[model samples]
Target: MRVAFVSLETVSHRDTETNQRFQTVLEILAARGHDVHCYCATFWDDERATLERDGITYHGIATGLEARRSFLIRLPFVLAASSPDIVHVHAQPPAAVLAASWGATLARAPLVTEWYGDGGIDDNRWTRLAANRGARILTPSELVATWIRERGADGDRVETIPNPVDLERVRDVPPGERVDVIYARRLDEGANLESLLLALAELRDRDWQTTIIGDGPERAMYERLASDLRIDDRISFAGDCSLEERIAAYRGAHVFAQTAEHCVFPTEMLWALASGCVGIVEYHVDSSAHELVEGWDRGFRTTSEAELADAILAAGDLEHRTFDDRFADYDRSAIAEAYLEQYRTLEEAYGLL
Candidate 1:
């Protein structure tokens, strides 16, 4: 099958979650002998205008003052030239939606819009119209699928497909001695790291240490908060880390703590689980962290600071479990097959099979 993916940026220049997810799916489909072509922004001058890597073809579009104008003008022609069986657009930068829709229509191919549930859409008229234009809407979680449906997309057109993880890459590493309680998310306002700091402060007398991973705009603010809370000495900030470093952090952690107000199936949390860390989520009305750890022996959900501290302490007592069947569904291969099934279904429905 010939597939065309439209996105604002490619993983070559940016390593965001959305880009990673799309690249994973593209690579898997390409491995299966499907022709996958990605049309994305040329984020860097050094990046080639057109290149092929890992069986996937990438076409980098122009960027700058007239980026949108150039993209809109070129997209349709590009799609016509590719003549893809299906057009899959990563839905974000809402501006790109109309171009993708236009390109798909021009190519007379089924349009599948993939959304990451990143809180960019808010029932806006244009966003809704763009979403409704898709032949199918793919979201990373049920929460996101429901959001799209409420925003004027037909319920039947929306589907939930969780992001895939390379389970073996995260789980097969040499196990390190678990010690510190770890929090591995961007140190941004939305992360709600203050809550975790306050919770840890309450357990000052406890023997456990804290390791804060990842970096962002609010790193200095979080560092200040830790100092003000008088827990700075017991906490270490590891900054932004590579994938291998992340896996090592998860393996060496006694507890994986999350205090985010919202998350769409965090990849780090999944890695933590795969690495056998005890999972503890701070409950929030909109957060889905609880869903990942719920029903596991070492999984916990805390509603208050005291409860969070208690949960962290309790996690230290629990033993790390082996990588079992609970995470099989999240494996990259499994997720790839699921996406292929969706593509096949769409082909049959559109009479392309």
Candidate 2:
């Protein structure tokens, strides 16, 4: 199978959630023996026409992000010549999807766009038109699927495909030093660490340790808040540890707290949950974190910080395990298979199979 990806800038340009997800998708296809090509602005040194790395061919569509308009103008002609089985685009700069629609038509291929709504895409007239252009729309969460549908994409065409995780890593990495509870997220305003902090403050009388695993612009403030609460000694400020380090902490902890006020997809929480932590998510209108724990027996969904505190305490009763198969459906291979199914269905629908 040959897939042509349309994105003016990729992870090489910047490591954003949107860019990273698309990169993972492209690599997954390449690793599985599918011929993959990405049309993007040149990020490597020199003005190379194409660069091949790791079984994926990247055709430079423009010089840099500044040439995005030119990228749009030249995409259709370039893609038409490539004649790929499918045209997969990153739906960020809205106009890119509109331009890719033209490319998909010229190539006589199915147009698929992956939209990560947490990137602050607006629902203006142009984006609305762009949304309707894709043969299929993929989102990281149903919360984002709702956003895409509202932006003019057909509800039937919007599919909720989550960010994939490596379950093997979860099961293999040994657990970090034991802690009673764990909370991980960038220590920014949206982190809502206070929800957990205040709850912890309320339970100062109890004997439990917490490992807060992230660092950001607001780390100092979160640390200050922890200090002011006088529970700083029991809390470990493990500023921005690596993936293996995070998984280890999650494995060691008995409960994982998801208190962020906004999230398109709770990647960290998912990782922690897969590491066998009992998930406790606080419900927020803008965040779909609670969506992950709604019906799960080993998880709790709360509406307030007080309730979140109670859930953490209640989680102590659950049997502790270092690893969990709770989220096997979200593994990378599983998600790749999901995409392969979409590819097959779309190809058959277009009679290209």
Candidate 3:
């Protein structure tokens, strides 16, 4: 089937959880023999050039304030040229999704979208309308799916597809001493990484190293917090490590932990499981991290700093049955097949066959 994916800017554009999942799904669909092409923004300098990596063809749409406009302007022409069976656009920003919906309508193809943002509909007034207009809506967690339904999307129109992990690529690295605990997230205001830093400080007496990955506006404040706690020496801000480095870090780590209270998807935790690290995540009402923890027994949830530390310590010694079974469900190949079936369903529904 021919599929067109419209993503404004994903983890592929930035090294964050959502983008990682975006790249993973796109790659998965492409590998499954679908004519998958991604329309994303050139958010960074390197993104200016177009390259086809993994199994997908990527076209860097455009950048800057005019990105949305440019995407809408060129998308119609691109769709005319490709004439895909289905167009699956991602992200929750109303204008973007709205434009994609219009494009799908003009192209005479089914439009579907995926959302993993807190502002699923509440982010802006247009969001809820655009989502409701789409043929289908996908949420990475049941929490997000419920949020979509509350915003007026029909329950049947929304599907819960958890984050996917490429289990094969995550081979256990040459066994290394398990002493490092890793936290990787965008240094964005919403990340709430400070809580995790404080939690780490509380566990200072324990023989463990803390590594912070990724960069964003919150870097300075987080660095100051580490210094203030006198845990600066123990914490290393390994800013923006490559995909390979991240996998290696997970492979060598004893635990992968985070303090992000809200999640559309937990990319870091997926990689953690793939690397065989015990998962430690914060507990919050809005998060899908619990799905990762509950779905895979390799993780534990805690609401307090003390509990988080205790959970991490306990996770290191516990054996999880859920890991083998649940992990299989989220594996890359299985995820690819699921997406292929979804595409087929869309094709049949639209009578595009």
Candidate that would win on TM-score? 2
**lDDT at 341, model 2:** 92
The alpha-carbon lDDT assigned to residue 337 of candidate 3 equals 77
Model 1, 1-353: lDDT tens digits are 89999887667767877777878889888988898988977754575678777898878776632476787678877887889999998877556777888888888888889877665356777777776768888988776776777778888888877877778786666655455688888888798988889999999987878888889999999999999989999899989988788777788887888888988766788888777788889887666678787788879999989999888888777876535457889888898888878888988988888
My TM-score estimates for the predictions, one after another, are 0.89, 0.98, 0.78
Q: Give the winner by TM-score: 1 or 3.
A: 1
Ranking by TM-score: 2, 1, 3
lDDT of 2 by residue, 1-353 (tens): 99999888899999887788899999988989999999999999987899999999999989888998889999999999998999999987889998899989999999999898775569798898888878899998878888778777899898888988999989889988889989988887788999999999988999999999888989999889999999999999988899998999899999998888889999989999899989998888888898888889999998887887788888889999888897999998999999999999999999998
lDDT by residue for model 3 over 121-171, one digit each (tens)? 474477667658667788788888887777777888888777677666666
Candidate closest to the true structure, highest lDDT: 2
lDDT of each: 0.80, 0.89, 0.74
Report model 1's TM-score to 2 decimal places. Answer: 0.89
Residue 307 lDDT in candidate 3: 88
Model 2: per-residue Cα lDDT at residue 260: 89
Off by more than 4 A, model 3: 7-23, 38-82, 91-108, 118-123, 191-194, 200-207, 214-237, 319-326, 351-353
